[model samples]
Target: MRLIPTEEQRELAATVRSFVAGRVPMARVREIAGSDEPYDRTAWTRLSSELGLAGLAVPEEHGGSGAGFGEVAAVLEELGAALAPVPYLSVAVAASLLVSLDAKDLLPGVASGEVVAVVARSDGPLPAGRIADRGAWVLEGVVERVPDGPSAGLLLVVASTGEGRRGVFAVEAGAPGLAVMPLTWFDTTRPMARVELGGVPARLLGESDSGAAIDRAADVASVLLAAEQLGGLRRCLDVIVEYAKLRVQFGRFVGSFQAVKHKLADMHCVLEQAESVVRYAVWAADEAPDELPEAAAFAASYLGRAYFQVARDHLLLHGGIGFTWEHDAHLYYKRAKADEVMFGAPRVHRARLAEALGLT
Candidate 1:
């Protein structure tokens, strides 16, 4: 079967690419990164409200486009190529955990860009003091490294119960005892935070036995991240390709040299492999429930490492300018680093893969 995008899908990508270029250029990204909001509200509104991107994957009944993961992947590719700093991943992917659970009432606000939601996870056991004792399920605990949490209007906090049950709780952004503080991070475009929850009113999502569903949501997020990373790696390669053709070293373009040509060829090969895996991952996200985790793991592990290497290689090819803040290479470099660990790091996904295959 052909993995190429359909005509309509190509149109969708072109539209998103043009929109992002017009609304959020590299200069705009730099401006927002230097701002104090921690996240860009205007850009988020443009994407979610004007572009309808926030609702791309939600059902029609819930005020979304009723599109599938493939459509979302297309949009994410454009977003990644531009390194556009919006909360699409947090609101579209993480908050989607609620959507998959059939939580429709929350979608209108979320899709309309009136609310921002984030997912919080960690490697260790879910901490105590994170769950609220009140009838409404009060949440109290600190979540480290929450993406877009500082500006999120809603939070989907994941915690474990005394009996080792995994639970997802919905907490309003402004509720009492909910605090979001920005963290110093390697990637400045995607701001992360340390979230503190205390006596925060929350509603439990799905049944207490919904750990399987939570895993599914994470799978979706991972697949989407892989697709995003693929786009970023391709963009990095594009930059190197352009640089190679233009930069003359010893009276010849760098691309004419054997070593540079081989490097670029390898980059192309890596990207093509990642592209196929991401396509499969997105397709599995929509159609193959049982295979979702495996698809996600394969895409995440390969794309994550591949994109990181592409970023470094792009910089190496660019030489001095790549190291400067003024150059766009560093921006993509930081994005690759950040995307590598988005839903779950490549290492974590590999471990999960081992468990799934009974090799652990």
Candidate 2:
């Protein structure tokens, strides 16, 4: 099957790329990355109100534009390409869980682009759930590193109450027992946080006993992340190709060299393969039930890691200038690295794939 994007999707991609270049320019990304708040509300509003990006993947029933993961993925790719600073992933993936599971009341602000929502999934060995005391739920645990936590108005935390209990909870960011502290992260385009939930009030989402909903949410997140990585990887190739054509070494354009040409060709091949995988994964996420896990696993383990490696390779091709703090290539590199382990590392995802395939 042909892997090229359809006219409409290409249009969508172009629109997103243009908007990011115009509105959240690279300079703005640098400014926010070095700032105390780091989150850009103006850029977020542009995505929500002007671009309708916040609702791209949300169902229509929840006041969203009623698009699917594929559409959302297309937009995310552009965001990654530009290293645009926005909370699209946290809202599209984390808050999407709430919307998908009939938790609509908690998401209109996010869908409308008025508030940012983030995920606080704990990294401890324990299972996931809310902590309750005296009949009132209180979140009291350490959520290792949460994305977009510093700017979010709501946090959907996945925690463990016991060995087998795992659940998703919605807690107001400013709730009495909650503390969100920004963590120094590698990817300035996306911020990370350490959450201290000490007796924070929470409301449970999805079925009381089943962890299926949370698993589905995770699957959606993994697939979307793969799409973002695809965009970043593609951009890295583009950056290298442009540089190779312009830069001269030994009194000849770098593109004239066989080694540079071979590397660019290899990068193109890897990016194309990853694009197809991400598209398939998004389709499986929306259509196939039993296949979702396998698709998500393939995306996380292969596409995600592959993209980061490609970005690093592209940077190396640029030499000393690529390593500088002012270079945009480093921004993409940081995001690519951060995305590799966002949902789960490649090794962890490969284990999941093995289990889904009945491979001991």
Candidate 3:
């Protein structure tokens, strides 16, 4: 598989970066994050529908660009760098889940960015949810910490079925007996909510045994998220380096000091390693599905640690300014810390990696 970006992918990444710079800069991020709104509707619509990014990985038959994960990863990276408060990651995860389930009917709206979907997490196999067929599929359960739950038009829930099997189900956000209550989270940039489904009509997708499908979705989510972490790490390095070069101490540039230089260098080393892992995972997502599990696990574990470390160092090196809420450093740091455990922590992923490699 080509780990290097092709010309088209390069253009796509550049365009996405430009869009982040022009539309979702830090000022806009703070505004949107601080507000009660789910996200920047205008910017998200333009990005998903106008730019057709929402369908970058959706098949053309389903109204998506028929592109692949590589392109999706590109957009994700840029969004990570900007800390753009959009539900693109949630949508992407849902798309991956749907694809694994071979459910293409929802792809049209998803590709068009007309329908926003987020995955609701359960503790484990049908942990606290049940599905019964009463002329129509109905779900009853409580899923907590659902990403983008408040803003999502649709929710893809992973629940245990009556057959003692795990399955994925879809429910409309406005469906009867469904309640999505927003939760106060550390990362204001990514919203979470608790969803209570009580006799809510839903659509069941995928086969009865959806374990593999769920794992695939998780793997894809991990790889893409790691790509995002890589972006955040890169941004942290950039900001810290820039600050070091400018900030003067005792009439000398801070970067010229040995201690500061070593810290920045260590961050850069981690950033470079993270870039490699994320890129390999991106390639495996499309070109080598068999390897995606291991690749994604590695990326997830490494980038989680890498981004948090760099973000921490970024804040520390910024002196007192970084500690203040006014600076963007804290935001990045929060995002990094939040992301580290968004899909289980680095330790969890390391265990997964070990299992995948038969090292357990």
TM-score of each: 0.95, 0.94, 0.97
lDDT of 2: 0.81
Q: How much is the lDDT of residue 11 in candidate 1?
A: 90
Q: Which 10 residues in a row give candidate 1 its minimum summed lDDT?
A: 126-135
Rank by TM-score, highest first. Answer: 3, 1, 2
What local lDDT score does residue 334 receive in model 2, on the 0 to 100 scale? 79
Candidate with the greatest TM-score versus the true structure: 3
Q: What CA RMSD would you report for each candidate? A: 1.7, 2.0, 1.4
Candidate 3 Cα deviation (angstroms), residue 17: 1.2
List ranges where model 2 is wrong by over 4 Å. Answer: 1-6, 126-134, 161-163
Candidate 1's displacement at residue 122, Å, is 2.7
- Tens-place lDDT per residue, model 3, 211-288, is 889988989999989988888889899989999999999999999999999998898889878888988999999989
Model 3 RMSD, rounded to 1 decimal: 1.4
The global Cα lDDT (0 to 1) of model 1 is 0.81
Q: Which stretches of model 1 miss by more than 4 angstroms?
A: 127-134
Residue lDDT tens for model 2, 230-261: 88898889889999999999999999999989
Could you tell me which residue pairs clash in candidate 1? 130-140, 132-138
lDDT of 1 by residue, 163-205 (tens): 7788887878778888888898888888998888776777877
